[model samples]
Target: MKEAGATRTMKRAVNIRIESKQAEQTQTQQAKGELYEKNGAYYLRYAEPDGEMGQTTATVKWDETHIKVIRHGDVQSDLTFRSGVRTTGGFTLPQGRLEMEMYTHGIDRKLNEGLGSLAWSYDMYTGGAHVGRIRLRLMIEEDRSE
Candidate 1:
């Protein structure tokens, strides 16, 4: 992936796994993508598998204190997580609309130029009712096979 005016953009292999346990089922979404760095932050981009309309593009931007994820396609969403704080983001998706408040309680990350990893967890609520606990993990490695 390449971005205009970016300090650096490197081809990378990204493994992203998102797990959410609501009720009794644990749903997981995994994908491979690209990674790059700009200024002092890192941005990872990936394409969701082609659906009936085509593929959805998603980008994850993170730094030392916060993580923001944006997805665009048939549906659009922007979610944010701040270190050890409560952050709220809501958007409509193909599954439905999810507009809730989430409290992040866990955050662990190690990022650099060549490789990086981030793990975070939070509990979501809707109308004061416990929604579910969600965890997201990312593993990034620079692609040097070229």
Candidate 2:
């Protein structure tokens, strides 16, 4: 895969799987999104279903050491992650929006031969109370049907 940028007219199909656990409750979600790379950063844009909370569009941006995730539409959030550093953002729920803190443990990224994977884990806190740890795995593959 090209590292700098994707072709302007090309859009690759990406598959995303996410598992989130809070307290004793766990949820798993899978979706298809569009993948594009620009200026050395890769982006994934997808829609998220929240049942009673409605739906939202999510955009994820990542480079070598940092990742930023944002959601819009029905819910909103902006979270950033980097290993060994704490980042702050906002999380929106049906009840309300709250400030959030995330401390990343590790991030592993690999992209080659039209396949890409990113793995990361982080600790989350809200209002000085520990929420839970989260692990995320993302995989992307080029759609070369053209």
Candidate 3:
């Protein structure tokens, strides 16, 4: 790991494929973004459409034990995922912030040299009621076009 005051971040244009499955519905979204490494962790930074909220910036960082997703701009959040752990995180919307929690049951990752995939499955809850089981998968690769 680098020192606390020293950090290295390499910005690389990358093509990403994100797939999420909730209940019987599955949504897939793709975008081009930058993937970087800093403080001994890998992070993916991207922009996503947010309907009336315009564009939302998303940053996903992960290590061996946990994964964190953060959003800024219109909609903001910081959600953490870990195996056998329930993490509390909510969404900040235009109207108000809605509190939510998620219990992660499975997490798997295999990344090498800034190119690979990672996945996780969890159950989401709102107001202490079970919403649905969500499975998310991400595939990342270095952009060859540079």
Candidate 4:
């Protein structure tokens, strides 16, 4: 781990694949962004189109045990997922705000050395109602120019 303020920045091609059971849909989005590491945590910053949210900037921060996703722009949400733990948070959208709970099944953090991936699966709930199971996978592209 580097010092608290020391950060290593690299241009990384990021691929995000999301699978939702309730919607019965699978979507894949790709973007090039800056990947930073500091204080033993990884941060991936990217921009993508989010339907009603227009263009949204997504910042993914994760350590070994937990992953928190924050989206800013037209929509906003802060969700924390950890293994063997149930976390609650609220999602803000154009329509309104909704309280949600996430029960993470597992979080696998494999980003090390040069390149790897992070994968997690969890169940989402809102207002005591079961939503769906969601699986998210993020892969960090290697820099071949080096």
Candidate 5:
């Protein structure tokens, strides 16, 4: 019984990791170009090698511990993607938030386009909660020119 319980717990943990990775991949494929905010709108621009360009709009929600964003637009051909990140570790001091950013580009599978990067940060709290905020960013650019 004890072994079975441990196995169940491990399975759940593995499932969470798989889900998180899937979410991260979805975000990476859908995020492209530069991010900007104007007035009350958030905008992103994506350019394809076929001379096609796209723009997206969405809202971002931020709290002391997490940041959630939802964007919708015709940034790609017949495809739409959504992504988010949440903090699991670290101390929450001074009420900080986690931020995640991702970017992607389509390129030929045999060539290199120099379009992959990731950035993450954690903000530690001053209180005794032993909690902190986590942030992650990822970008990928592919060469679509054949």
Candidate 6:
């Protein structure tokens, strides 16, 4: 099988569902979030339940087989991930929940060759505090020449 090539950019939107465990959190905390991509860098805005907000930026790199996410922040919890077209090392955040559903093309051949679509859930904790959790589902499809 032939490996796929990376596109210049990827665009996706996720619908967030508030779990029972997270319903009691502050609405300002949820509303104070932003996602932006510019010049190959990604930016994320996070708000804490206590009404504190912070921002993090990362450089996104991708190939046919994997993705590399490097973050710039004072804390290591700055790096995070979502499912791409192929298998990837996902991410964890400092607070709240992030869920992603990914769709790809021409991955069945890779599965037959012992490389399978990647799926995972990550929960990041600091001390006894439930920092955050992320869930991702990846889907693969075939590319169309037409």
Give the Cα lDDT of each candidate. 0.71, 0.77, 0.84, 0.74, 0.28, 0.32
Task: For candidate 3, give the lDDT.
Answer: 0.84
| Model 4 steric clash total | 0
lDDT of 6 by residue, 15-56 (tens): 222122222442311222333333434322333323222344
Question: For candidate 1, which ten residues in a row score worst on lDDT?
Answer: 1-10
Which candidate has the highest lDDT of all?
3
How far does residue 7 in candidate 2 sit from its true spot (Å)?
7.6
lDDT of 1: 0.71
Residue-level error in angstroms, candidate 4, position 97: 1.0
Name the runs in model 3 displaced over 4 angstroms: 1-8, 49-53
- Each model's backbone clash number: 0, 0, 0, 0, 12, 4
* Count: clashes, candidate 6: 4
lDDT for model 6, please: 0.32
Decide which is better by lDDT, 2 or 3: 3
Residue 129's C-alpha lDDT in candidate 2?
Answer: 90
Q: Which lDDT value does model 2 have at 21?
A: 60
Alpha carbon deviation, residue 101, candidate 5 (Å): 19
Better of 3 and 4 by lDDT: 3
Which is the winner by TM-score between candidate 2 and candidate 4? Answer: 2
- Which candidate number would show the highest TM-score if scored against the true structure? 3
**lDDT comparing candidate 2 with the true structure:** 0.77
- Writing each residue's lDDT as its tens digit, candidate 2 over 1-146 gives 34434434355786766666656777777777887767667788888844654688989888777999999877889999999999999978777899999999998777652257777889999999988888877766654544
TM-score of each: 0.74, 0.81, 0.90, 0.81, 0.22, 0.26
Between 3 and 5, whose TM-score is larger?
Answer: 3
Clashing pairs in 1: none
Pairwise TM-score winner, candidates 3 and 6? 3
Q: How close is candidate 2 to the true structure, as a TM-score?
A: 0.81
Q: What is candidate 4's lDDT per residue for 30-88, written digit by digit as tens?
A: 56666777676778877854465577888888876789999888888889999989998
